[model samples]
Target: MFEQLGLIGCGLMGGSFALALKRAGLVKRVVGYSKSPSTTERARQMGVIDVEAPSALLAVSGADIVLLAVPVAATEATLKAIRHLVSKDMLIMDVGSTKRDVIDAGRRVLRDHVGSFVPCHPIAGKEVSGVENADVDLYVGKQVIVTPIDRTQPEQLQRAVDVWQKLQCNVVQMAPEAHDAAFAAVSHLPHLIAFALVNGIASQTRAEDFLTLAGPGFRDFTRIAASEPKMWRDILLANRQELLEQSQVFQRTLKAMEAMIEAGNADALEGFITQASQLRANWRMGPKKG
Candidate 1:
């Protein structure tokens, strides 16, 4: 699909992209760069990329497609470092969880090149990090949300969609603001609650003992708490307004449940439980393989 592909930050996301493209024969060459020497070396040893660049600029140079797989906080800095080197023909895209900030940063640094940059968020990941955990099929059948601004070129948007389709992803397009707001409720707010639940429990007496008795439900609910803190922190801050609103809604729901339990309102509690159960059941019916 492309002559050469560049990946900036070869951690889980970038490394996985490289693996996917090569596995699908979508690219002839993949050049990757990461700040950590060990990560770059690991990616090289794993055959995730044909070449490893020493800097972000070198990695993106002469490439038809470039992916910024760094944290939301580092997106702007990475874009600035490679803005001048990025060829006009290159299709630049970011896999950051948040979109508005990254899209704005692209507009500022990339200027007219903004049309080439597509802000995308792949709603798929593992708790594990590094090149070792990278899988070629990581994005297969996953939903990839592409946020294109008014400045985005039609051809560039089509190219971005085509690339994700090649990776076997279900591609969907949305406005950057809408993407942020929706994800704030579904993704960011859930992560926050998981972290808070784990921390709150840890503060209680016999916390370690309580953990030993916890079941699959507790384990599943708090699994996201194990994700990289710095990355999640950046995502939360970047989408703070949407996240805060979601958090408030969550807080209200929690308070209502607590009040129902305290007042021994069986009917109200049952109604809440039924609604939650139905929502979860419906979610399970979405795009899952047997």
Candidate 2:
């Protein structure tokens, strides 16, 4: 069990993580900090954190494990804030959706202490955000992608895996670049499409009329469009190159289907639909448990 968990960013992701660790008896105390004083205060009042730190560095003052749940854009500044207190034995991890940029920030800010930092991306969260929406079951049975660089310490990596496993999370390791590329296609691109789809429809003349006719399929497909704008904005920009590459592939496939429909080629359309149906039917999410 960790003596103390220094949680930076007391929002949905960090609050939920602190709650999870507390529930699993993995950490004895949680010291949380947020950019907003009100957020840190609320997290403390809600029992998500045992103490509210005035600054990021103080949050990690005596902690053995630290979690940076801030946006990918703020990673470098956050690392710089707490770098002095970060030690070789400490296991520092981030829940940034994109790993390549986060790893780059760690290298630049943490320097020789970078080995203590383990880049992590937990494939879990809701469209809703904030400390009030934090749930202890957030990480339960979820797939957490840990992207470790060459400088990462083996002991620190094991500690990170152990912490997640204790929280009932399925731990998977990958190179930072590979993790970004894979998630761009699976996670990032989908959110981008969802955001764009909603905006595209809203910009049309009959936007209200179109929404009134939306069915369950449309609701489900556009669900991610409700995600926090600032968080998604950072994610989209951070993984833009990979996301754009995935978007191009998606556009080509869409154009192919459009061409078939325009030509009245039912056979080709059915073939394309069948391929996608099979692919989706074979996919499964990580097991979830209470």
Please give the TM-score that candidate 1 achieves against the real structure: 0.96
For each of the candidates, give the backbone clash count: 0, 0
Clashing residue pairs found in predicted model 1: none
Model 1 scores a C-alpha lDDT of: 0.91
Best by TM-score: 2
Q: Give the per-residue lDDT of model 2 (tens digit) for 1-290.
A: 99999999999999999999999899999999999999999999999999999999999999999999999999999999999899989999999999999998999999999999999999999989999999999999789999998999999999999999999999999898899999899889999899889999999999999999999999999999999999999999999999999999999989999999999999999998999999889877764345
List residue ranges in candidate 2 displaced over 4 A: 287-290
Model 1 segments more than 4 A misplaced: 285-290
Give the least accurate 10-residue stretch of model 2, judged by summed lDDT: 281-290
